[model samples]
Target: MTRKLGLAGVFLISLAVMNVFADRSDKEVVKRVNSIEVVALDSVEGYEKKYRIPDENLNDLFAEKIDSLLNSWYIQNVFEMPSGGGMQDSLPVVSIPDSVYIDRLQAIDSYVDLSFNKTVKNFIQLYTQRRRDQVEMMLGLANFYFPIFEEALDKYDMPMELKYMAIIESALNPTARSRANAVGLWQFMYGTGKMLGLEIGTFVDERRDPVKSTDAAARYLRDLYKIYKNWHLVIAAYNCGPGNVNKAIRRSGGARDYWSIYYRLPRETRGYVPAFIAAAYVMNNYKEHNLQVRYPDFPIVTDTIMINSYLHFDQVSAMANIPVEALEALNPQYRMNIIPAKKDKHYALKIPIESVAEFIDNEDAIYAFKRDEFFPNNEIINPKSSNSHHVSNISGKDKVLYTVKSGDNLGYISEWFHVRVSDLRYWNNISRNLIRVGQKLAIYVPQGQADFFASVNRMNFAEKQAYKKKTPVTKTTSASTQTSADGKYVYYTVRRGDNLWSIARKFPGVSNNDIMRWNNIRNANKIQVGQKLKIQSRS
Candidate 1:
């Protein structure tokens, strides 16, 4: 059943997100993200104008996802950054001289060059100055992961300082995923992870296993070092791959050193070495720059239990008294919170040291807790297999129109409507990020509350502001699912702890996108108090 909410009249949201061209005459552009509001210069009564300096060279090729990193299961559930006392309030400008940085670099013992240059200086400043809080968080996370890294690097007889590459690769986040599809702390692409003997299967992606990925990364670094004995060239190759590194070397007329082939390297590769050097410097000399080490609250001691049967985190939580979040933090390799341990193959599960004995005592009970529900038909539903990605037999998004309003940029509108900026452009045939006032743009959204999204066209500035308050969004978000006419396909109502990932697992062939379409949501659909998860058969 396609249920549509009976939203009242024609209120509006301006289709134009906001224009970047300041010289053009347009209505005020307002950017709202969650609770934060950003108004364009000269658009608001008390606002003042500002300008930005351009830097085409050495722009962030490896953008840091500090927020996402901090939001990972390991940090959110297992760790806490207790409030830093007002010590941060009364801080003197902390800037070390270039010579001091050079001295510190020379003091450390490592096989890498550890050379100082303008690019290295800039990146060091980025960690020390612009993102101190995030760096502090990384420093704290290092307490747990650094030992594993050191052990792996030592086993390979590689420079221990090379561990800093994880910081640059993922800010030491186990779940970090790049826009280019590289994933985990070591940022391994699917092909690379597969080639390196890291298992990427239905229930597990070993790329996210800190220990496995770290060891694999060390092996990879050693191989690169073998190909090119110079660490700098090895680092460059790690970033852009050996093919690009070879091209850069060839382009530089057979130069063997990193600096000699620097200009010939890809723009991102040029910054990779410098960023790695800066990361190394910051991790070592953070205290000198008035940065405090945030501490990880995760258990310092843990024990591993091998499983020869299929298991779910819920089962562990119920039997071992461990929270699912902690289980996820400990075993990120289990993509579905499931350990698909077979009779011939066993899988390792980590628990706090105290719970190990109890877990071993009740191991049978844990596996049998909700066996039928979890492992339907006593078989693991491999989501990676063929037909796992749902392609709707019916069209998903219904098209609606919104007139481009003043101050609209592609970003603002995309954010407002819960659609991708790229999708918005592709749908409207937009060539660039710019949008003109009063241009009619087609917005494709689920049919349930198309009225709310459609309101963008008719509402005025004040009306849109009032509508944008978003306080009563609960009314919209609580839109429930009604089964299809024949009731053949299964439907799941949202629950408090239920997320798209977790919910999608219940339906073997359903994609998260299909679930989003059915649930009348665009991006994030928080399962509120009134929300329900409908259960039906997939006919």
Candidate 2:
């Protein structure tokens, strides 16, 4: 009887061990699913804090929603793994009650249940005081853009939630430009804009035209969706590129979903999709976060008219009895208030619908008045007069009207003139860098601005200051000074916040390419934050 009892006890112990192993397998699967990160909740919390939302109830609601969304069983399945036979389990199960999983779920629940308190608390911790002010300013502008974005997305059969893309891209600023030269509300780079049929030129970048840009963005998003067959990946590709997404997928070993491949993406790309999702969530729950929309000063109703003449927006505004600010807001693409010099083709002009008839009635009179006002000094209006005066007065006079020769382009001309292609275009109304043979080009060899040159002469200035202070002259000079051959030329030391365009504009006659050449820069796009250059005198 004693032997039988001992055998029974051993059998029961074996059964218990098997049961434990099975439980472990289940837990491992849960662990893997929990590993999937949901970045939107944290981002929303940060945004909310930055905005200083005081309402407790609204904050709680957002928190609750975020928790529900993030803590779903689907997310767990994706992130965690099952546990069973210590390394022998075929299917891994997540370990339930793990601190990470429990805490994450609890945090989500806390956000939902705590009302405005959690959101406000999260917001306060997320942003600094200055950022909070910027957030407030951004919220004011959101009213102007959100409606337009909503309408455009609706037309494209896209989700209304996608309107938040503009908020993330530009804070709804139609004229926003990124460091990479991505412009306007959609933040499209030159290449991508061109691909989407957004025309860019000196006078107008269609990327800045809100209506057209939005349309292009919608179509681009649709195309991305068609390629990836996923809205999340489409948003990711919008920030980084479709190629990047594809590369990330490959890196992730052919993981088909966003979270699975997110870690394999570039740092900025990883953040971008999450930021977008967060923006969508926050915008939808803005009221909960105590965000109030400040209505724009202009009326929503507007009209479009066809304009054949080379007209100024200011003139159109005056003729139509519309405020210049409103007109500018409606048509941000006109960089200098004037439309591109079209000879016969008509361009669409947006005006207050009520003002359309008034604009038509006074079109001729308005054009005449504007011409008179702008050309009050007729001598200054004539390019020939200015050129003649420049030739006669300026030293280093070289009279060369070089008709563009074959194989000659803006870059070649810029290299020849020691000027940037950008500056050549600015001076000569050249819309693009492309130049055809027989195209007449103007070359200006600046002369005689000793004082201007002296002002930027870093070596002499630095030596003089050092002498005055009776300090020892020591150490290597800055990059800007080093580039100057004689150490007598002016050098613009690139500061932390300096850019090529701004630095070029600071000194007269120094073209963008001149700065590049002075710095021995191969690619204009690759300038670092603190790269300096010599400033050769243009005058």
Best by lDDT: 1
Across residues 329-395, which tens digit of lDDT does each residue of candidate 1 receive?
A: 7788999888999999998888767578789899889999868656767887643232332222226
lDDT of 2 by residue, 57-148 (tens): 22232223223322332222111111220111122222322233223333431111112223223332221121332344345456556777
Instruction: Give the range where candidate 2 is weakest over 10 consecutive residues by summed lDDT.
Output: 1-10
Candidate 2 stretches greater than 4 Å from native: 1-130, 341-344, 372-539
lDDT of 1 at 407: 75
Query: TM-scores of the models, in the given order?
Result: 0.59, 0.48
Model number with the top TM-score: 1
| Per-model tally of clashing residue pairs | 18, 53
